[model samples]
Target chain A: MGNLRERLKAFYADYSFYILPVMKFALALGIYVLINNRLGYMEALNRLFILVILAAISAILPFNATVMIGIALIVAHCFGLGVETGLFALVLYVVLVLLYFRFVPRDALVMLMTPVAGILHMEAVVPLCLGLVRGPESALSAACGLVSWQFVEIVHDEIAPLKEADAGMLNVLQSIPASLFSPKLLLCVIASAAATVLVALIVRHMTTYTRLRAVIAGAVLYLVIMLAGGVAVGVELNAPAIVAGTAASAAVALFLNMFVYSVDYRQSRFIQFEDDDYYYYVKAIPKMRAGGAKPVRYYDDSSRQNGTGTPVNGQDVDGVDFKTKLEDSLKDL
Target chain B: MLTKQRLQLMISLADFKQSHINTTMRVTKYYRNDYVAVQLVKNFFVTSIAYLILLGFFAVYHLDFLLTNMNNLKMGRLAAVLLIIYLVMLAVYSVITYVIARIRYARAREKAEDYDQKLDLLANIYREEKQSSGNPFGEDQ
Candidate 1:
């Protein structure tokens, strides 16, 4: 596990700039495919050529700009379905924007995860992961993301109804209350998310447990929450499937935590220092590194040795010796 | 609102607000308890707006149902109840955070005091070594 984590860290450090852009492009493509598959807006918008272009552009653009483009795509798709659907989507978008600015403007990750989690039906993972890695406040953003996912699903549901109904705007608007606010579904999603957040927060505060253990606990808690929440809300759930999916998500979360919060378990050092009147106690945690590397030494052993090859104490080395020592250290590395 | 002085003041105030927000956000890196409180306050306001919007949508579409049920529903009373619930939750969260912060502070103070004692002992040992060697520079010289 340690070796794999080291390799992963090295790989990330070496190619993160390139890997991140490619990952963004892939995420954009995935979103496009999911949206197109669900909405089936227009052939022009759904074209492979257009999606590739959009994904490429989104990958290079700033996160906020990318989110704006995503919003625009959702709007366009909704408009293609019906005017009322478009307006409803606009309202959802406005609410999301308000929530984003007011609470979690920095949380682009949650915004990206919303559609992904919704489509995958692994919504619990978002809250669980956020609670472990982020503060309790991120729970709001995770809930917002889930809500946005539901909003999109609601918009999608409206498409068939809007197409079938030849009635006026009032009649169409009336249909929204039932589809838009299915209290049972909303309750289930919110309850599961809130439960996950609570479990994650509790696990995070368990300083005695390893992060890996905490992540596993979070995943198990998520599964328990979903099962209990589903039963309480009378929501139909494929229990075995959810269990399997959440377990897989938990495994992924554990792997991610390993890379993100890697620490050397054996190398804890305590030291004491003083400056004038004040004293400081420091517990230094040294990160685990690959075995073949060594820290650079700046002082020369030769400079600290006398003419008869005996070690001289408290000898100050000059700049030339220091430069030689640094070069030698670098060469050894 | 469009006056020159007003505009300048508004810009300055906006700048100050932005800087303040940035500083507070950075504080989360060092202080988890404070960040949790800030997040709770922010989430409360944002979620309240979202809930209100959802309610507004439902109320606008189902005006007749709301009107008929108004006597039993008592919207103002419900709002007051929600406000009370929010306040209670906030108070509980604040108290919990305060306790955590106090414990952390106490632990840090204990560590500092321990370090100070160790530092004093080390200083005394160094003084004894120097005196025994009969040189102010000690054995290293």
Candidate 2:
């Protein structure tokens, strides 16, 4: 595992420029494909060529441009459905943009992550990952993402009725307030914010297996809030899906934590010490390394005179002077 | 004729420039006060436009009731309420933009200072080489 980590690190360091653009392209393509599948109202916009071009452009542009392009695609699809639908989507997106840029401009991707997870029935991963990696402020972005996803779901649900209704502008506009401010959305936003904050808090305070503990706590807290809140609000609860999603989210968070904060807990130690002004207790955990300790051979003048070289266990160092190499290696250290 | 140290410094400088060019260009394009003020005005206009659109939606949603009570409605009070909402939105957005712009400018200034220091170091290296070589342009005569 340590060797794999070292290799991965080296690979990233060597070709990060190419790797980053490839990753951006992949993310952009995935987002565009999902958007087309979920809300492919306009046949022209849904063409493979158009989506690919959009993704390609987003790959080369800044990350925030990708988000903006996604929003534009969603709004375009809404416009294809109906003028009222487009207007509603425009208003909601504008408000979300204002809120996001005004408060958390740095975490633009987080605002998109929640809805994508929701589309995949894995929204729980968002808060868990956010808690593991980001500070408490990220909760706001998660909440915004949840709201956007919930609004999209609402639009999807209301699409048929909207089409059947005669001149649905007034009726649609009237219903917007109630649907957008539903109790379910409120509960979800609260639950997501609470879980993120709690996980971040636990991770901040705890020292041992901090990411692991935080992921578990965040997953549990999110599940509890969602289940309890869903019931109280009379919203039909998908208990199995929620449970499975939370478990999957926890697993994903742990996997990411393994890559980011891999440490040798077996070699961890605690020490107590005192300075002139204060006492301190410190816990130290060794990082995982690709190389184990190399055996250093020491030879005295008497051994050299006897012509008996230092023995290496199960290893060959034939025809090489140990003293010069040892001195050079020590100097490097 | 580049030495190893000089090549390393040049590489570091190039890397820094590549990473910071966008931010450096933006920061240098405008005076600090003008940038922040411009942002504030831009945010104010955006807020005003959004608030107007929201009001239009609200009016459309309540068009039936508003029409029914058209005779009884007080236009002055309604206009005042709308104006108040618009003002509040503008004020909030203005403050947010002000802080964001100031922070962006300060961060850019810090990077610019670091870049300037690197330039100075490179220049000093050239100056030292020229003195040691006893030539005006640090080249063999």
In model 2 chain B, the worst 10-residue window by lDDT is B1-10
State TM-scores per candidate: 0.58, 0.80
Clashing pairs in 1: none
Q: For model 1, how does the per-residue alpha-carbon lDDT over A139-207 read when each residue is reduced to its tens digit? A: 667766766677677666664566666656656667765675676457646654664566556665444
Task: Summing lDDT over every window of 10 consecutive residues in candidate 1 chain A, give the lowest-scoring window.
Answer: A310-319
Candidate 2 Cα errors over 4 Å, as ranges: A164-167, A260-333, B1-5, B28-31, B136-141
| lDDT of each residue in B1-20, candidate 1, tens digit only | 12354333333334333434
State each candidate's clash count: 0, 0
Q: Write down the C-alpha DockQ for each prediction.
A: 0.16, 0.12
lDDT of 2 by residue, B1-141 (tens): 356776556555665665676878787578999989878877877777777777787888789999999999999998898888888878877887888889988888888878788879877887787777778766546
Q: Residue A330 error for model 2, in Å? A: 4.9
Residue A187 of model 1 has an lDDT of 64
The whole-model lDDT of each prediction reads 0.63, 0.76
Q: Calculate candidate 2's fnat.
A: 0.15
